[model samples]
Target: MATTVGVVVFPGTNCEMDAVTAVEGLGGSGRLLWHGDDDLSGVDAVVVPGGFAHGDYLRPGAIARFSPMMGAVARFAADGGPVVGICNGFQVLTEAGLLPGALQKNRGLKFLCQPATLRVETTASALTGRASVGDELSVPINHFEGNYTCDDETLARLRDEDRIVLRYVDNPNGSMDDIAAVCNEGRNVVGLMPHPERACDELLGSADGAILMASLLAAA
Candidate 1:
C-alpha cells in the first residue's frame, strides 16, 4: 500500500509545498492538512512544514500550538504514528509539547539562511532509519530562533537517553550539544530545525535530506 504523509500547512507556512513535493517524489502520497482540521484520518505519517506561523507573533509557534489540528497531531503521535517537524514545524512541536526543548533566538540574534553540515547520531528511530549513526550530510536551515536550549538536567537526560538525533558539525545556531534534531521518548516523533525537504531535490543542490524523508517512507 502507498504511504500517505500529511503535510500540515498554516498561514505563512512557506515550506509546505516543498515538503509535499518531497513526499510525493519519494513514492508517498502527500496530502495537505489545514490547521483547522481535527482529523488526520488516513495519514500513515505527518510532516509539519516550515514557515513563520501566525506571523511568528508572541514567540514563534506559541499561538500555533493551540490550533485545532494540534489535538489530532497529539492523538496521532500517541497512537504511534510517525511525525516529522522541519524548521518552523520543529518550533511548533516544541510549543505543542509534542517534543521537548525550546528553540530560542540565534545567539547572534539574526535570521540565518544557509546550508549546514550535520551528523546523524541515532538510526534507531523511524526518522533516521535510512541514515546510519555517524553519517554526515548537508542540509539547509533558515530561521531566527533555531538555537535549541533546554535546562542542564534536561540536556543531560536527553544525552543519557540517546534522544538527540542530529548534531551540527559546525554548530551554527549555538544549540546546546550542537543538537540539530531530536526524537521523542517513543522515538516515533522527530523535530529538526533544518530544511531537509528543501534538500531532497538534487536540482536545487544536494539529496542528503531525502534520506530522512525516505526513512519515514521505509518505516511506514
Candidate 2:
C-alpha cells in the first residue's frame, strides 16, 4: 500500500504544501492535519514541516507545542509511530519534548538559507534508516534559529547512544558536535535542521533528500 504521511499545519505554517508535494512525488500521499484538531486520521507517518508557527512569538515553537495537534503527535510518537520534523518544525519537536535539545539563533546571529552538506551519522532513526552512515547529502537549510543546543549530559547520552542521525560536513551553525539531526531514545521521532522536502528534486539543486524521505516512507 502507498504510505500516507500526515503533514501538520500550524497557524503560520508555510511549507505544508511543499511537504505535501514532496511526499506525493515520492509516491506517498500527504494529508494536512490542522493544529486545532487532535485526530491523526490514521496516517502512516507524520512530518512537521517548516514555518514560523504562532509567528514564533515568545520563541520558535514555544506556543505551538501546546496545540492540540501536538498532543496527538506526541501520543502517536509514544506508540512508536514515525515522526519527522524539519527546520522550524524541529523546534516544535523540542518544545513538545518529542525530541531532545533546542534550536537557538544561528551562529553569527544571521538567517541562513543555503545548501548544506550533511553526513549520515547513523541509520537507527526513522529519518535515516535507509541511508548509509557517512553518506553525504546536499540539502537546503533555511532558518534563523537552527543552531541545536543541549546540556553536556544530554549531549553525552546522545553520542553514546548513537542517536545523532546526521552531522554537518562543514558545521554551518555551530551546533554542538556538528550535529544536524537527532532522534529520540525510541528512534521513532527525528528532528533535523535541513529541509529535505526542498531537496527531493534535482531541479532544486540536489535529489539527495529522496533517500531520507524514502526512509521515512519505508519506516511507515
Against the true structure, whose TM-score is highest? 2
Per-residue lDDT tens digits of candidate 2, residues 17-96? 99999999999999999999999876999999999999999999999999999999999999999999999899999999
Candidate 1, residues 1-220, lDDT tens digits: the string is 7899999988888998899889899999999999999889989999989999999999888999898988899999998899999999999999999999999989886789999999999997768999999999899989889999999998988899999999999999899999999999999999999988889977979889999999988876
Candidate 1 structure lDDT: 0.91
What C-alpha RMSD separates each model from the true structure?
0.8, 0.7
Report residue 38 deviation for candidate 2 (angstroms). 0.7
For all predicted structures, in order, the TM-scores are 0.98, 0.99
The reply for model 2, stretches above 4 Å from the true place, is none
**Which pairs of residues collide in model 1?**
none
Taking all chains together, the TM-score of candidate 2 against the true structure is 0.99
